[model samples]
Structure formats: C-alpha cells, structure tokens
Target: MSAQDRLVGAATLKRLRLARGWSLADLARAVSTKAKELGQPLDASVASVQRSVARWESSKGPILPGDRYQLLLAHVYARSAHGQLALSVGSDFSELLYALGHLGESERRLNDLRTLLVRTATDGGSGLLALLGPSTQRVLADALADPSKLDEELLEAMGIAIRDVNRQVGSLPFVRVQLMLTPIVESCRRLLDGTVPDAVLLHLRAVAAQAYTLAGRAAFETRDDEASRALYAAAAGGVGPPWRRAVVHMSHALVTLYSTPGIEAAQQLVDAAVRDARAGESVMVRARAHALQAEIAARAGSARHAKAALALAWYDIDSDCDGDPSPASFSAAHLRGFEGLTELYVGDPSKAHDYFAQSAEALHTPRERVQHAIVSTDQALARIRLNDPEAATELLHGCVDAASATGGRVAAIRLRRARAYLRPWRREDWFADFDDHLIESFGA
Candidate 1:
C-alpha cells in the first residue's frame, strides 16, 4: 500500500533472490513459465510482476510454501550453478559458496565463518555439508554473528535442511545434484595443487568418499545399480578408518546384488565385509556391515548365514554407543531401523515390530524415515505370512505410498513385489492395480 511498505518488500525479495543467486529477470521468467504450465494467464505487466514475484520472495509478504513440484524446480536451478562452480573450483569451496548463497542476513558473520572454514579445511571431513568449502566461514559468520550460535545444533540443523530439500522431491527430477560432485572433485584437485599437507589430503579424500556415497545413493534410488556400485566402490577406497571403508564396501555389495548380477561376486564382497567388520573398531560400522551381510545372505538363500550375520549385528548394536538403545554412528535412529530389518528378515516378527516402532518414532530425517517405512513393509509381509492378506495389503500400500513420497524407488519395488505375490488370492479388480504398480515400480 505505502511506498515504504513496497520498498521493504522489494528489498526483501531482492535479498532472497540474490541469496539464491537468481536475477530479477530469472525470477520473473520462472513465475511466468510456472503460471503458464498451471494454465493460468500471467498479466505480465510491471505491476503484476511487482505484486506477485516481489511478494513471493519478500519476507514481509506471505512466505509461500513450496510443494514437491516447485521444490524440485528450485533444486534444479540451485544445483545448476552449484555444479558448474564445483567443477571449476572444487567441492570444498563450492560447498561453502552454496551455504553462503542460502544463508539469510541474520545467519551471516565473519569470524565464525572463518572458524568454520578452518575447522572443515583442517578436520578430516565431518558433517555431510562441510564438504562444500572454506567460504562457509563467511557464510556461517554472516548467518550467526554470535560465535556461540555456531554449535553442533546449528550443524545438525543445516544437515537437516539440505536433506529435506534433497529427499522430499522424487529422485528423477533432481538427478542434477549428483552432477554437482564433478565440480567438487575438480575443485579438490585444484586445491591440492602441490605439496598439500597429509591431514588436508586425508580430509579431502574423506570428503570425496562422501561425495561418492551421496552420488551412489542417488543412483541406487534411480535403479542405475551399476553406477551406484561403482560410486560406492570409489567411496570405499577413499579415506577414514577400516570400519568406514568396510561400510562403504558393504554398501557396494548391496547395490551390486540389487542389480541382480553375479551372485557369487556379491557374496564374496559380503564375505569380505564380514571379515573387515570382525577386524574393525567402530561398533556402529561393524553393526552396519553385519546387517548388510545378513540382508545379502537372506537374498542368496543362506538362511544359516543370514541368521549368523543378524546375531552379529544385534550383538554390536547392544554393545556399542552411549545412549540408551544406542544410536548408530550413521544416525541414532537408523541403526535401530536396520536392526528391525535384520530381525524381520531372520523370522522374528515381534522383535522386528518393536524395533521398527522405535525407529519410526525416533526418525526425523527424511531418508531415515524411508528406512522406517521399509521396515513397516517387512512387517506387512509378516502379516501376509500369517494369512491376513487384507491387513497386509493395507500396510503394504501405506509403506509404498510413503516410499514414493520420499522418492525411494528401491523400497517401492520391494513393496510392489509383495503386492504381486498377493494378487492370486485377491479379487480381479485388485489384479489391475497390482499389475500397474508392479510395472511402474520396476519400470518393466
């Protein structure tokens, strides 16, 4: 209404758009295109643009919530520049720039930003997002002027934000995020030009491993199993301790088996993971390796081996970590869910249900929650085994929908397989739905 109000709104919009590294023209084009796609005619006048685009970006105006569709578009735009920069500079610097680009004015500070840069640049790669860059120092400093505010809580908050953005949208549309790693790897190469410290190199290697792991997970979700296996293998060879290496190798083995190729090779890799776990120090990592081995053993029809792997995982779970029920090193809640999955696969429904419930309750992260949903699906299968097809179908449907919500294709496929198995006993109408879901889930 007032000029002052309009100016404030415009300034806020300008600030947010800049933070996202988008220009006014870019924002206007996006708005117009989105409106057209929605079958709404854009007025396309200066006044209309000011009222809509400005208000959308403005803090004073209503902060429009992004649905999955809009968020997917935003991620596309964000990662385009991010990927290019990563290739040019390296991940360490690119990641910092990303943090800076996203930070609100209140979140920025100088010295704190410097400290973060120094810590990440020095430490052997800690947080998931820390792989971005040293410029995070400036970004974090600007975001939190008071040094005290940049604690573990803040780091977790940042990790959660990144995960939310990456996971909420389906994986198909957001595949570009994986490409961003190329620039990151390139940047690391430039940063290590010559005579780099051993610690820094180690940290860089650790960061690269994480980059590969992230890319591998993305590939796995997209059913590019070979790509996933290759990325996980690279990650396994990167850095950190033997336990971390073993975990990565175990992940590689899982992806390879999922690809349905060479069962003997997959089994050999699993066996190696088991041997590594036995020799490793980290209880959490050992537990994960064993859990994965258990899943592989089950799939390979080695019921005895599966049970033994499950027992090893449970033992490690009970012994490791400080918290009650103990958190997995990966995430406190994820470990619990994996344990539940192991239980279900080993034919212990009651125990599986208890662990699944715990994981479901404790999960806050999107990925971890998807894992919980898979456990729930396994519970549904257990119900089906007991002849309650109706109850089992309901649970399966719920889990499948939840997995789809998070873009978890692997979990969706498993649910579809279960549904297909139930098709014979169900009514004819259900057959069509089951068939459609199976095709969609498997892309067959």
Candidate 2:
C-alpha cells in the first residue's frame, strides 16, 4: 500500500474507533475472533491491535480483512456503551487509538493529545480516582509538596509538566497548577532513599537546575537581585558538564548585567558564559547564553557587538533541538521586546515598534507580559526624542496603566522617568502625580 493510502485508511479507522467506546484489547479480541470465523486469523493483543489499527487508518494501505474488522468493531462498540464507564473507558480507548494513528505524521500533535488525556484523567472521574488509590494519591501529593524531598524521576516529570502547563496557560501565575505541583515534587525528592542511581542523580540535578533558573527569573523581576543571583548560582551548581555549568554562568551574567556593577566586569562574565555555552551539549542552553551575551553587549554601548550577539541569539532561537525544539525559543515574546528596546536604543523606533508588537504577542506569562508596558514606555521615550511630547504623554499613560495592571513596578518607574523627561513640554502640574507615584513605588 502507498503511504498516502495508508494514512487515509488509518485516519478513517481512527475516527471510527474513537467514535466507539472500546479499548484496543476489546477491539482486537472481537476483530481476531471475527477474522478467525472468516478463515483469516489475526492476532488480537495490544501490539497486534496497534499494528492492525495502524494499517486500517493508513491513508495509503490496501484495505484488507483486518481493516474491515477494525471498522466493524468501531461500529459495534460505539452503540454498546453508556454512562461514566462509557465515557471514561470509551474516551480513553478512542483517544489512544486516534493518537496512535497520528503518531507517524506529527509527533507534536500526538504529544498534545497525550497531554490532554493525562490532564483529563487527572482532573476527572471516580474511576480515575479509584485507579490511583487514595494512598498513592496521598503519597504523590505529599511528595510534590516539598521540593527538597523529591526524587530524580519525579523532579524531571514535574519540570516537563511545569513547562507544558506554562505553555498552555500563557502565564506562570503564582497560584497556578505548576506552583501547586512544586512542593509535591520537592517532597518526593526529599523522601528518596540513597538507592538512586547516578544517572538518576544527573537528571534530578537538571530538573533542580531548571527550577532554580526559573525562580531566579521571578526574583529578578521583583527587584530581589540578591535572591535572584543566589538562585541562578544554585542552578549553576548542578551536576553536568558544559551544559549545566554554562547555564549557571549565563544566569550569573544576567544578574550582573542588571546590577550594572561595571561594564568590564559584566562583559567578562558574559564572555565566559558564551564560551561555556558554546562547549555545552544542549542547544537551549547555548541559545540562552548567546541571548545574555547580546544583552550585555547592548548594555556596553557596542551596538555592533550587541547586534552580532543578538543575531547569534536569533539563530539559536531558530535552530531545532534534537527533533524537539525548546518551547522557550518558540514562546520567546520577551526576546522581541528586548530586540525592540535594542532598536530603540540604536535610533530606529519603527523597527523597535515592530519587534515590540511581535514580542507582546508572544509573551506568555503575566509577569513578563507586562514587558509590553515597558515597550510602550520606550516608545514614549522615542516620541520625546522626536519632540512629540503630546504623543509621548498618551503613550506613557498607557504604559503606566499596563504596568499597574500587571504589577510591573519596574516598568512603571521607567514610564515615570520618561514622563519626567518630557515634563518641560507639559504643564507643571503633570509632573507631581507621576513624580510622586515613581517615588512611592520605586523609592529614591
């Protein structure tokens, strides 16, 4: 059978199977028995069913007895089940088969389907509740409640889940499911016996490292530079060669860039991070290191170096990762925001606005989404540069409003500064309100 024919058949079989409420085993059993009676026997195990189902759903396959049996089973099963069992068992079976049908075509779509199934099962049903005994549920819940106690496997799973959930929701709000899952994961780690293998320890360290990196980002946003630095440093301390160490150093570079201790010191740190990241294994880590280098260069008044670094960062963002690119690359609205700011600094507000708009669209988290407000403030600054104080006032007001809504005090302060810079073109009274607000929110 041609590939196209197999895909067509597979898709049809998948729809029919899902429309029915039967498991692979159930369908295999019925189909196998029917085939036997018809003088053609086929295996009915999960693997056999999987294969037969694959053939039937294949768009390019020659439709055989096995395919016919699969279609028949789907027809019979859909009309047979009812109630919670019907919904639970039927949906699970159908979803699984449907998912399998798409496996060869789009792995990402299959992954999405699987995630949906797991999340649905997690959130639904007394049947699911019974499947996971109360004791097991309690254990998992307790384990995830404390990060310091989580084992390696659980930590890695949690890390993946956190990223997945963040992608789905577009924001890592403090009260989100990821936050709820963190403690349970930590608890599991803490409860781990010394029997864990070295391989497991490596994986655990990676998960912990990622968690610390995220935590540091949160801290940095809140103006807790000390805490942010500590978390980033902790992430760096995790075990692994170039990848892990490079990430840690990059985190340090980020903190240093923001702290602005000195251009020379910051550039040195950035250079080291870039070197380590280049030697690292993960493309994601390398990309981040490059991004940080770009930021540092941008801050150092070397527009040429900044542009080069940013270009490298963009390349990393575009590169595919081991068949599965990092979501950070795809979901990086903040990069555009940064790019917009970079363009603005380099005297190209038009390009800056375009990048800023793109970044705003890509931003996923509330904390970072407020970065759009910062962009607006920067736009206002640009307008001021152009001697368009009236337009700048309007933009700054929007910036303030956006920042206030998202709890972006830092952005708000910047907006206020922009307003202050434009005060000479405004009534004297306009200065007091923004001035007082900045002082109150950001202090001296």
Candidate 3:
C-alpha cells in the first residue's frame, strides 16, 4: 500500500466537502435534510453534525462514518457527482448510491404510470391510445377496424411476425429491432383495447404477451430497466403455456439481477421459471432455466449453488426430448456462454476461457454480433486473469467495433469491465491506444 492509501479516507472526506464549497454547517444541513427525505431522520442537529464533520475530517477521526451517516453522505455527494460518485467515495459506496438513486427514480416513474392508469380509468381511456406515436396510431387504426377478424390464420400470421422480430433481436442491431417492436406492441395495445369477440380473448392475450416480452427484451438490452420491468409484468400476466411463462419469468429474473440489489427477488423469479419449465415438459426451456439459476447463484457468490445449477442445466440439455414450439431459443452455445460467465464470477479463469472458446466456436456462421461482443469480452477478462494482458487487449480491440455498431448496453457494460481490468497496464503504449479507441467507440 502507498502512503496516499493510508490517508485517503480522511483526506477524501475533506476533499469532497471542500470541492463542493460546503461549510461544515452547510454539509450538516444537507445530510440531515437528505436523511429525513430517506426516512432515516438522523437525530443529530446542525451543531452536533458540524462537530461530527470536523472529527471525520481530522486525521484522528474514525476511518469512516457509521452506516446511516455513510448512506446519507453518499446520497448527498451522489446528487451532485454527475456520474463521478465513485471518485468521491469508493466503488462499493457509489454502487449503493446508484442503486438507491435508480430505485427512487423508478418508483417515481411507477407512481406516475399508476396515476395515469387511475385517470384513464376515470376518464374512460379515450386519450390513452392517442398518446401512441404516429406510426403506431396508423397501425392501430387499421387493426381496430378488424377487431372481430382475429381468426386462426390471422393469429398465425401475427405469431410468425413476432417470431421474426424475436430472431432479429440478438442478431440485428438493437435499434433496428427496437424500432420494429414499438409499433407491434402498440398494435397489440390497440387490439386489447378495441371491442373483440370473447371466443379469441385468450389467444389475443397470448399474442399481446409475446409482444410485451419482445419489448421487454429490447428495453433491457438498451438499459431501460423500468420499462423492462413493466413490460415483463404485462408478459407474465397474459402469457399462455407454461413454457412461454417460463421464458418471461427468466427474462424478468435477468433484468432484476442486473438492475437492482434484489437478489432474493431474482431468485424467486428464476425458481418460478424452473417450475413452469418443468410443468411445460420442455427440456430445452428447463435447461435454460437452470442456466439462469446458475447465473443468479454466481452473482450471489455461491460457487456450490452455481455449480449444482449448471450441472442440472447440462443434464437437461444432454437428454433427448421431443420438439418444442416455444419461440425463445436456447442452445449449446448459449449454455456455454452461461458456463463461461458463471466461472468468471465464481471459479477459475482457465475454465472460463475454455468455456468461452467453446461458446464462440458453437455460434452459428455469421455469428450474432451482440453475442460476439459479449463473449469476446468474457474471453478478454479470462485472459487478463491468466496474466495474458496483450491477448486480452487484442480480443477486446476486435469486439469494440461490433459493440459500438450494435449499441447494446450489455456489450458496452462488458467492454467497460474489460477496460477496467486493463488499468494496471495503462502506462504501456498499447494500453494508451486501446483506451483512446475504447473511449472513441463508446464515448465514455
């Protein structure tokens, strides 16, 4: 450890305070106010808080404040950091602050949506459909005219279109699939809104569920967590068939795992997926559910649970089974990707590298660009762990273009992680060039 490391806690506290041009008293008021807003309501008044701040800034003070105070401090600093919160506190603290902030923002948005729904209920929902886009409005108008014609043939046609859109999501650019999905979902909304024959209500509900599932996937890939959750909720409520419900549950589990600090919630979702997959008797969907469970376990740092889940996943995939009709695809390549990611989290890097290589090899010809970027990043991280920094750098360099072109938030996040792993080599000429290339591609 360096001398700076020894003094960082005390010095950083003082630096952050002075950087904001906050007097001790001013900071005390802010902290107290934020605490009350968060429902913690600290008992310390301004005079006591001012004294406490002085002690914390002194070299003789405790290394950090108590937990409640730390939370308030993080909230106070995070409000003004503008994405630089990690620099003020540390990564762990910054993560807590970001999670809290996202929760608050999402809660507010949810309340607004609830209010809209209440008003729509009171006002007969006349203007709610009008809030759709021009293209959506046009499509809705056309669809609403034939609300009684939702026959088997028409439903099959819609199913084909939905499957086509689903196939395009990981294969085509995210923005393209997203553009195609909005109108389809809005059309579904119109179908559900217009007067329809009761005989086909269940089928129409299933169709709407599929559209919402696709929209949820699009929103998730683009990092819109709130929209993803809402869409997943809609999909879960209306989806028919256990296998389809399993798919929706697993998709919801993934976004929950990534976006919130709710590991238990994610676990519950994955468990529900597993149950539905079993009830549906789909070996492939069951295998995917187990794989998702492994991912959740890995995220929770439980190597034993992750390994057990992966074992079940492998067993299910290897078993022979009748053909399934669900549109959600899960193959050996995806399983290998799951294994690589799990190992990267909880096991040895050499094993992760082997799994990633298998995943890459198993991908179809003209491999999915977004998947390529994500797997390439996993491979690069494994290389870094194996002490092959140059090879890691090369792997990351090859994927930046695809990631930038596809504009997948998952790809961007993985690339950022890879870049962080290379920070120790930042003084090297190659590192400098790669850093510049990454920044240029992803725009910070």
Best by lDDT: 3
Model 3 residue 235 CA deviation in Å = 0.8
lDDT of 2 by residue, 25-102 (tens): 666666666556657665456577656655545555534433355334432332234423221222433443343354
Q: Residue 119 of candidate 1: its Cα lDDT?
A: 35
**lDDT (0-100) at residue 434 of candidate 2?**
55
TM-score of each: 0.57, 0.57, 0.66
Tell me each candidate's RMSD, in Å, in order: 11.1, 11.5, 22.4
What candidate 1 gets wrong by more than 4 Å, as runs, is 1-182, 185-199, 300-304, 320-364, 426-444
Q: How many angstroms is residue 122 displaced in model 3 relative to the true structure, after the best TM-score fit?
A: 38
lDDT (C-alpha, whole model) for all candidates: 0.54, 0.55, 0.71
**Candidate 2 stretches greater than 4 Å from native:** 1-137, 140-153, 164-195, 239-252, 259-269, 281-288, 314-327, 330-336, 346-368, 426-444
Once fitted onto the true fold, the runs of candidate 3 whose alpha carbons sit more than 4 angstroms away are 1-143, 365-367
lDDT of 3 by residue, 280-316 (tens): 8578899999999998899889999999999999998
Candidate 1: tens digits of C-alpha lDDT, residues 233-284: 7777765766656666776676666676667777787777777767767777
- Measured by TM-score, how close is model 3 to the native structure? 0.66
Q: After superposition, how far is residue 112 of candidate 3 from its true place, in Å?
A: 43
Ranking by lDDT: 3, 2, 1
lDDT, model 1, position 116: 34
